[model samples]
Target: MAERQDLTCDVAVIGAGTAGISAERAARKAGARTLLIDPWFRGTLCANTGCMPSKLLIAAAHAAHAVRHAPVFGVNPGSLAIDGQAVMARVREERDRFVAFTKETFDDLPEGTAVTGRARFEGPGQLVLEDGRRIASRAIVIATGSEAMIPPPFRDLGPRVLTTETLFEIPDLPERLAVIGGGPIGLEMAQAMGRLGVRVTLFDNSTTLAKARCAAVHDALKEAVSRDLTLRLGCETSAEAVDGGIRIDWTGDDPGRAVFSHVLVATGRPPNLKGLDLDRSGLALDDHGTPVFDRQTMQCGDSAVFIAGDADADVPLLHEASTEGAIAGRNAAAFPDVAPSERNTAFTLTFTDPPVASVGASPEDGTICGRSDYGNQGRARTEARAEGVMSVYADADGRLTGADLCCPGAEHLSHLLAWAIESGATAPQILSMPFYHPTLEEGMKAALREICGKTSQPVPESRDFGNLPGG
Candidate 1:
């Protein structure tokens, strides 16, 4: 019999997902002897399943849509057929390449760092592996990513009912697909399938889609629905099955029956905190079942231990997960005392046809300055990509509280918004930043200008400002 090994490190990060990997890198950069652990693979959902593969599939669907519809642009490209199985293969190929790329990155990390099998805490600052080995660390980071929130009645997924994770593996595109939940995941999948010539109907339990983003984001998404996707608004799903293909029952206040061939549920996500005994580690859970910790420090219950990413609960997006992971890692290495990083910012992107991106608060979160929409512009039409809008909300002082965008380059544009919010830059300051013309991001600049009541000069940064709008 092999002898059990006991390991020790300055920091131990659990789950090798986006947040986990980021935390590992941040910890090593901070000179902490870090031990990163997960289930063999170094990359989590973003690397293996969630972000990468899904986006690739969407990209393929977009290409197919573009090719078939090129005649509208007078290009005369005709007769397009989608080999969905081949698309899935290509997606898988890309996924494998990305996973390998990440493995290479992980291999380049400094020594004394280790990644092991599934680990469970025996006590505070102590973990036991599946092989009965033990590892000790001064600090811990829980970056375990989230899993699909399977809707009721369809909890047992099969031929007809599918979750986000399983939907990616689908070989055949359904003739009609019904996606429950109007959030980013649901909208993206709905758009992808709809573009691939599937009659896609999306249901938003509430009034809006992508509720976390701005109303303008939904406005843009509505344009996509106008194009192809069918939306069943103000509806809630009761159950689903796959008899002939798929059938879902949804009920609204009005008299109507909604059914489809396939059901994809993307309502929301619950943290992957089940099975793991958090109470044994002295962690407190919030109402959302996420780890309740100091937002600044990522400390759970005590400073000696910490957590990050979806495992922590409320903050679920990739950007939030990475930022929280970095903080947790830094705090773990610099135990007892550490300078707080004011660089806490998040950028969220919904991977749709014209992907929606957002930073800061939503209009629903008690806005100071209300929202405004940048309607369909010539740039989007020219690129054949104009299907969304952009909006932002800020306070009287022009501190950005929220931004929502549904447009091309929304993901990239949202980062700028996040930067402005983090730096306390007002809407005027954002407008002051020079943006190249004929770009989708100009919409964000335009939005800022509309709120600030000024158009920036060609060389705006050179001006000697008397008082900036927010200041």
Candidate 2:
């Protein structure tokens, strides 16, 4: 072995992904010397594989869907042809640009701030790089990120099996696809492929689509996406290598067997802790094998170590990961005397046709709320995409608690609710806000009106307010 070299920093952040980047910036902003280490320096999973590329493909798929359904608008475009190869190429081109931007951002970090090598724990506050370099730090943040999890049984299926990591790299779209795990990633990819003319069969062990907390949203999502693809929910599934492809077998109320050219597994993500050797760090692991970290401070137990992003398992969305990273980084830099950061309201979205969005606190038993079906909403009907529902929930005190939306413009609606809930807005206040006529936002207003009626708070009467200054 070569002689070991030693370096010291105020903070050391593992992984150069989004979380790692945010952590580094936060630590540096706190006047601490920060070092970021990773073997590969692609920006993040979102820019490279998860969010950006998937949306590009979804955009192309939506274009194809729109042309095919143009008759509703009294416009007939004839013989719409979809070139899968061209679409994939365009997605790659745009994805590469995003990846390049991430790389550039990393490169622009302050000089001597980053190292390119795999790092493992040598001891508490110590890291050993692959080539015999050692780093001593006052604090450590594990933002090592995660990898797409393929169940053990399907690991040996070779190239026919794909994950978010590999799915975007395919040169051409497959004739048929078997998507396992009907979560956001699975559903998004399944619908995109189906809309792009690929035969897609989606399998989920869970009975509900997207595991929606609201039954109305769950039913609406099932109704909307099931129109484009075959969904086999609430099933136990198995797969085997076939002659030219793969065979998927499932047992349930909708049990069946099918062969597909490719199988995309969006089951879950496991933290990339294989080589970090957390056992040497003296931090306790949770039931999921992740380091025990406070959600508020992002600190691992009471140690000088921190965990963030997908590594925590509890916070998986990109924005949440970034938030955790910022918190962990700041706390790591100020350990033993740090002010804890308050977590934002829970917000998540699935990018489908009508989209699926959930925000703020989850609905619980005895929770009274309001519901609106977009099928009856004017905007959705006018757009010929009237197939979803929206629900807004408020506590007995009339404060907005949460919302679930499986409707057109659900993304925007979720943001609105997240802001309101975080700001402690009441249902009556939300109802009093202006809702323009014949817009998707009117659907939100309709739900708010129902919630307003359920609350003990009196709806504002026009006469209750004073006249304008001019009057």
Candidate 3:
């Protein structure tokens, strides 16, 4: 390591989050010298905000919810108690532990591997740091990730408005929560908070819940979630700071006004592209200022520049980000002779009680559909959790393409279907695999049977494979 203000490297990566770290490691493994830079190297957004902390809150809420519903199963569980302080305390402490693990990655880096500053693109292969240091590299990888957006309406309300980045830091649960936006973040946070005894109203301009494209999934999820929170879907909303809290007014099918202690804006997380001076990079950018790039190679217009993760805004999951990073890093190490990486079957999950999920390709015209309604399902009815739908899609050739699921075990079922689709399995092939008796997975099997009946050939008939709709 030298004390030179101007440093040279084979690859320079910006923002040491999930994508950046993976890219740096991949570049190094490809026999290229790499340097990683960020203003604060304090782990990824998942460890700090998005995934882990939200799950901590959801876990607490689900525990409370289970206790309240114990009487339905004839369990004599006593009155439930939700200690807000203790709940948030455990969340923050456990979150810090996970963050500590991520921070250790930086500690393990060899000398001069990481730089502590934000970077601006000077050209295709050059960067200038905030402290006036210059970095010359053969290739540059942009893995800056993203930030939670605050829309115009919620901007001036100050501390009462919370995004994922600031939600976990709240001292206590809100007296009344106005969750704006019905995307995955909104649904999970609103339902979790409501179940934990907060008065929650989930608002969205569209009637869709969890952004479900399939009408069956949308209806089932909406009906189930309405049990916990007030849903004000398809409404135009406005807000302002009142004397003690925030006042929100809505106009639509039902016009109304209400005051809430706080608002959780879960609209979406747009890519973080500000302050990069990307115009200086001389790469073509879209109307949104995002650089034009190939998703398979993660390259920016055949130049020595690559983008991955939320910076590219293709697939925002951590695993997808890691994949993109590996692709970008390997290609950056061998610029102009880069190879394309194969992508995985896509899936996204929203952790509601009966989770909402979509896996693989979306259904289109001419696609055959198969359905399993969980309302009368054997395992669902036996567990008293029967209240959703699963819609599976297939090609005209009988091969599985995708599925939309809103059911008790949608997350697990989504994984199974994603694997089936990735393997290019037909519905009949998946049905040949054993499905256990009286389990949520049996519900998935039922759906495959429906697909079997619709496809070119049916899955071999099993004698009452648990339960059919009329069985």
Candidate 4:
């Protein structure tokens, strides 16, 4: 609590999350003195609450599901017991390990390089902490990350309502859970809870699940998830604290209500710009109170201020956050001469059974699409995972554009497709690449070959960009 402390550095980064750490490293690598400031010491959202913890929960759910469905493969694994306490213990134990690793990064920083306090903009290149400390820097990077949002109806529901952040800390899984939202977090957690023996009812105002853009993949995923939980898609609902738990009331696509032991609000997580006093920073903020920044360069307007990670994006994924953090940090160190960084093709995956994955651009009107059903796929049949579908899209000129998949091994398929898209591989060129027989990847090849057959466009002898396969 040094009331008269004043510090100066070439770059000042707020929030020691993934983006902030990356920014600090990049700034230092660029030979600029940098200071990282954060009040919380837990870790990045991915390690603590967002990605790793949730995936751990999903892993437990997958195990339970496999036991229940073992009869289909003629292997009776016997009755399954989901020890809720043990599951959560392992989740926290492992989660803390991830958090500890992140904490090490900050702890290893040189003396005076990290500060623990909240800060506000005093003016351009100047910041004042609530502790009466001042910081003057050549440039600044905002990487404050995001937090889960709860609507008015659920905000007052007391401990009965939880967010992805709080859900992991609970002692045990609820006997009955009401999950509100059909987005990735909502759907993934809902199915996991259901598979773990919780009576889960998922409600979303939109009928579309997981933002499935391709209709075939949408239907396939919807069908698969329906078996795992109560899906009340296209339902408008509100909650009230009641006896035993909370009650949900709705009258949209569905006209019914129910009460649950607990409610999870997964509607959204806007950037955590609260209390930063952004108005004093001389930045233009949209109606959402987010700073208008150049997403390509991670620069705010043409100023020395840069914004990265969840705080700067409407769609914040971990990989993109990491990418932006590096870009913003480098530019912040080399201010007034910012340049846009190269970005990879878009890729997303919902970690569910028969997980949904999308890569590159989504299909547009008149885009030629080739599809296949896993119900007839050779490897799928052998694995008894015949409950999904996939599609790969191309333009009339016949270059690979993108893909939508809701099938077994989708995580792998989407990655290969993303690389193909990045490599600028065409349908025929991808087909020409050897696909081992009777594997799930053959399903991808099936869709791609179908695209080649459906069009009379001459096959490209080479679309490898520079990496000619088997050359």
* Predicted model with the maximum TM-score: 3
TM-score between model 2 and native: 0.96
CA shift of 336, model 2, Å: 1.9
lDDT of 4 by residue, 90-125 (tens): 899999998888889887888889988998887765
- Where does candidate 4 clash, by residue pair? none
Candidate 1 per-residue lDDT, tens place, 190-227, comes to 88888888888887768777654555567667776557
- Model 4 misplaced regions, further than 4 Å: 1-3, 457-471
RMSD of 4: 3.6
What 10-residue stretch in candidate 1 is worst by lDDT?
A: 462-471
**Candidate 3 Cα misplacement greater than 4 A, ranges:** 1-4, 461-471
434, model 4: CA deviation in Å? Answer: 1.4
Models ranked on TM-score: 3, 2, 4, 1
Q: Lowest summed lDDT over 10 consecutive residues: which window, candidate 3?
A: 462-471
Over the full model, what C-alpha lDDT does candidate 1 score relative to the true structure?
0.72
Cα deviation in Å at residue 333, candidate 2?
Answer: 0.9
Query: In candidate 2, how many Å is residue 242 off?
Result: 1.5
Q: If both were scored by TM-score, which would come out higher, candidate 1 or candidate 2? A: 2
